[model samples]
Target: MMSKSNKMLDVQAMDTSSNTVLSVRHLKTYFYPDDGSVRKAVDDVSFDVQRGRICCLIGESGSGKSATAMSIINLVDRPGKVTGGNVLFGGRDLLTLDTKQLRTVRGASIGMIFQEPMHSLDPVFTIGEQIVETILAHEDVPRVEAAERAVTWLKRVELPNPEAIMTAYPHELSGGMLQRAMIAIALCCGPKLLIADEPTTALDVTVQAQILRLLVRLKDEIGLSILLITHDLGVVAETADDVLVMYDGHIVERGPVEAVFDRPQHPYTKALLLTRPIIGQKLRRLPTLHEVMREVDDGEIAQPKDWSTLATTVQTDGDKGEAHSTDANGNDHDSTPILTVRHLSKYFERVHGLKGEGNVKKAVDDVSFDVHRGETVGLVGESGSGKTTTGQTVLRLHSKTAGEVLFDGIDVFALNNRKLAKLRTRMQYVFQDPYSALNPRLKIGFAIGEALLHHKLATKRDVMDKVVETLELCGMDSSCVNRYPHEFSGGQRQRIVIARAMALQPEFVVADEPVSALDVSIQAEIINLFSELQHRKNVSFLFISHDLSVVEHICSSILVMHHGRITERGTVDDVFNHPKDDYTKSLLDSIPASNPKYRKIGR
Candidate 1:
């Protein structure tokens, strides 16, 4: 590990002898209120980025890592102010610079890759045009030169057919492509420093790996320093030279990437490591929102001391690292298949152009799986890989064009309309986006109680009591009963959704990416909640998500889907350890390693 003296000497050498890209000191950025108090967004955060070195800021959603990065770029919008801080670039104080100087500094001296590329890039403008415009804006270059530079930068980011991608609008490209385009535009100027904020958040696991590799390769070739702000510890482990762990707007821990991850001292940091999903680990349950909230409130940290050893051993130098499962309990529970699907196939009619093509697009093709009672079956796949479609078909949300969906020895599809309605009560669904899934006008009480009311499980007088009980069960308070969906955070809203789904005491649930949009810490809570409920209610789950690591811990059985087909399906240990299919291997390779100790080598 690099010593503090050596680090200071290196920084001094870079600034005086070579290049010291960017240096930030005691940054205190805050969002002021209309009244008097202030919301400390980035409170007294200090860090530096040497030439070509990658410094990652890892934390939960509200952790102020992104806020600090935004302030560095002078792009923190209204209500947010850079209260106190010294942002130095090339030995100059950027915080003291005027608006015109900041403008010149941005794009020319420093570039940023925004969180969401789709929102960052304009829909009307061509990708090439945007890149060219960015180039011309900073440099005194002609249209032809700018256009050539745009194509070159596009190719530099490994975008296939650079010229064609340049002409295409932001909407015309895929999510991954749009992200690459954004990166390309950022690199068009060849800025000394690059700030990437959750660059691969919305992408599939495979795409995310590809983008991370690209960023690392780009950094190496360009010798550009990067300040990467992300919640994903895996990305930080793989790419970060040093890491700063943030919590509630404060940098709780900062050290060399290996030192911080291998021996994380802080309580918050330890909880974060415990919360992550790892291959081979068998999770009894995820922590509930209320459970984690209570812990956070009480200032409690990780449970077992054994977890620290595990965190220390996690390989960070690689893209894919080996995972060791820690079984706190030695008791083995009975595993009997509860929900079974035999050769399930769903086909949709396609209308291609003028002619109604007889193309029967198979969404879930010849897929057969079983979820044991009180066990979770994880369905892992990329978007359009039919993971979601499989979950829906099993739930009979969409009719299965072929095969059988049996729930406790009964064929779900064979049931009549009335019988189906009754059967539907036995099965529940937890959607990805809770805000859209839940009705805004309805209060939390009504929303949760509606299921119980529909199933005729409770009387009108007892509905309120049941609702309160269900809310508490899902780690929510009765005080939240009158509140609307928008009032709660994303994680809180998801809990309400889960409470509604489990209210009727459904025998099984199809949780489609339940915690995909949630923060890492919140995700841990939800995972724990699911496990607790499954144990208590003896409910089965069909867990569908793009996060393989999360799936590793929660699910007993695993299914890898690709191009509307099940490429691999088996026990979590079997599939993750010895993946047969090339696609399955690829998917496994895509998972981000939370430990940088392991060298980045494909599985």
Candidate 2:
């Protein structure tokens, strides 16, 4: 069915792959702030993603990894301008393309899978309609033919009942289902390249694994090049052929995946890899970005004045203080039990089959956990394991179908509306995404200060003082008070979220995968910030994450969830050392490490 000439061209492309499918040279993306200066988001960065190999664009939040990805797709809107450099794709300079020309190549030549599936999907459109629309946009294909392709692609991505899913709206689908649907839609256009920007950041561990495997399989089958923008080094080890390390809008290092991991030439890359929580590492506080940056500055490289000044600022008032409680071992562990859940359960109705007999899906089944005062208790599991559900239930965001949630020994579920509102003052949550969780209309000062106003914690004058203080406490400056979340970088926004969380000086906090959305180094800083807050404020934490390494790093105690049940619970050392549950052992073993040298490329 394939034309001889087209097949020849494909083979030729593979043979001359060294020519580079996409080459970015001296690229600079600048955001002109209202103050008239450029932000220099992606400054003088260069890298190449080959025709058949996966290229990983790695960085911490605000290191400009995502900005580079958006720039390549011409998705950088106004205020943000591509100030310089060439984005060469298939020998053609994409930077020179007009709006019409860019549109012609966008979905057809390059497909994009965004970070959040929930926000990316159109609320009104059915999943099938979205996929079909994507396909027909590029090619004038028949509706029936496009629909069939959509179904097949959905099934290929391991979605169950493709037909049923096709008819379902995005809201009706689970997080994993919606993500798979987004992938199916992206692939519908048969693009030569795929830009996956932290695509698995929102999914749980098992689901994230499945999605990564699916992408690798698709790439192997079709030889479609992938540009994976992620902060997860484990993902790079598992999926990338070559790694491009970005720091401060520049490529500090680039090499084969194994080489980068095994013998990292850059100090920043080395710090990122080691600072990450791994199975064997104890749940101890990691060094802050300030510390790492200091080390980098003091080491072989001399500190630039700008970086030196920034580091000085972070040390003075930026660190809020540790949030973890000390255990008997003098390690970070809170034994006070600030929040405790006993036999908590939540269920949902799921349509069974064609007979339409709905079955109750036990989302959180008989799950029990404890969050100690001044300690971080990590809740980790696969997507369907109900980690988020448990967190939400503890927060009363989702009413527990059965069981008791006690906050500071007070029954949270038993509290009246007014009592609950009063109780909320001492408890807060930080979401995985700062963009969605934040009120865009409110300035950073107002958003962080709003909680103080609601709780009557401070007067009008005190509010501004508190806002500036909170911002500084979270590693930001007083000057950021009037700035909106949109005006800040991803790392800055996350810091603002942390600032907001600290506004009330709450005794307990639920940090739901806060760092999973951040780049590795940014994650390190945030984790350290949480550690500092715990020590200083003595607040307990329910740290929910799919990333085991991160959990191992920050959590004093670990609760392993499987199929909505507590499979294992123990101190970081006990669980990592013994791992009584086979499921827990399996999860630990599944983490991708630095690839061995000379292993088969595609196994």
Candidate 3:
């Protein structure tokens, strides 16, 4: 076995002559808030990126992953400053370099791919113009040559119709196209070191898979070193040769990918690994970070009650269940279709050239599905595949251009405003972004209780009690009702949102990307919560998500969508084990296996 010092990459060996591309030691980045206190965003962090190797930094939001990357690039702006650290690139200390010298090295020697490509790209300029600017900034290339190079890189990234896309603005391109554009810009200068921060976080599974493949291919084709920062373990398992796990501003774990995953030494690392939802390994409940590490748990995370008993109550108390479950022969047909959508279509008109007749974009084209009672139906697809639009159209969140929606046998599309408003009490929607879901000024209690009162299900005096009960069902407590959305963490805020959605005791719900933004640990918690809710309340869910691994865990039935059409649909085992369509196969292929043993070669 290698010694402790040999277990990790050594920067001392760099010695102004080694092949280490970038090395950071004892890095400290702190911020001074208005409360007169110092917050260490990155503390005592150390890592190295070697030549032609991919080193990944995995952590949740505020775990100092992005801060560390920005610090390496010396881009930390005001109020936040790098207090102490040594960043050595090509034997030169980056901190000691003047602005002019650092500028020269920025793009010429280093390239960066940001998490959100749209934000980094200029809205007014075409994609080609941006790439040309990058090339000209670092090299003495002429305008025509730079433009040609831009088109070449776009084609290299496998973007469709590269030349046509080059002349389009950022808004004119799709999410995947824009990301490829960003890659073209970053690589136009031919840098040696690539720093990619959550490059595929917001993309669809297929697009994300394609992007991951492209990055790996680029690393090999160029023989360049890569420093990847992301929270997705699947991405790390597939792309990383070395791994760094961060938590609360500390490098809690570090080693080769196989070594770290096969034998996780740190409690945080172990918990994070356990928290991820694998293909066939299902856990009873996903524990939080506090459960794994005693220091972070705060002793207040809510525990779930027996879910079977909860479902029994819903079945016995509600008269609707009995009415809907009986067959003509007096036998029970419990697997009744609760929500039915047929030939549903949603479209938007796009105005061109400021005045001509608009072009119609069919967001949801002839979609159809039936969600059975007590069963979770997963609507899986890539971004712009029309999954969200289908869900919204079924819920009548947006008026459908065509087709029919049946909720418990009532024609939802034919219902008038008053009837539709009344029907909404039984059908609800959970938004993707929890941080923006709840009202900022409203207390948690008000946010939840408003739903109860609006539906006339609870009195003014009983609303708080109902809110508390809903919160409890969601693994929260009455104490949380007094807090605001901003005070809670991302996972906690999602719980609050779930609590509000369930406050009306809705039988069917459209949950859109519910846990995509959360850490794996928190994701497990939410999934467990959903499992319990499903078994207890028997509430059917139309769970819409871009992540196939996550959808594979909680969904009983899966529907695959691509280009606004349902390409495939079946039970989890039938669809996942024996995929039929090409698009479906690609989605399954894209799911990064959680285990290192399953890591594919040349990903």
The list of candidate 1 runs beyond 4 A from truth reads: 1-19, 34-37, 283-305, 308-337, 349-361, 414-416, 601-603
lDDT of 2 by residue, 1-603 (tens): 112111111011122256478877778999987888878788887777887788998877777898999998778987999989988886688999999999988888888999898898999999999999988888987999999999999998899999999999998998878888988988888888899999987776666767887888898988889999988777787888888888777777788887777766666765676556545544435555456545555563332323323332333243432323353243544456788789999998888788999988889999877776777788888767888888888889998889988888899988889999999989988888999988999988888887899889988888999888888777789999888889987778898998898898899888887887676666777877787687778878888887887777677789999888999999878887889999998777666553434222246
> What TM-score do all the candidates reach, one by one?
0.88, 0.77, 0.89
Ranking by TM-score: 3, 1, 2
Give lDDT: candidate 2, residue 567: 93
lDDT of 3 at 77: 87
Q: Could you give candidate 3's per-residue lDDT for residues 1-603 as a string of tens digits?
A: 112211232223322337678889889999888888998998988878888989999988988999999899898987899999899897788878889998988888989989899999999999989999989998897899999999999999999998898889999988888888888888888888989999999887777878888888999999878999999999998889889888878887788898877776665676577567777643334444444444213332122122222222222112222222111121222478999899998999988785677888988999999988877888998878898989888988899898899999999989999999999989999989998988999999998888788889999988888889999889888899889999999999999888899888889889999999998888977876786676677788899998877777777778998889999999877898999999888778878867667866373
Off by over 4 Å in 3: 1-17, 294-333, 601-603
Going through the candidates in order, what is the number of backbone clashes in each? Answer: 16, 15, 2
Candidate with top lDDT is 3
Better of 2 and 3 by TM-score: 3
Error of 3 at 412 (Å): 1.1
Which of the two candidates, 1 or 3, achieves a greater lDDT against the reference?
3
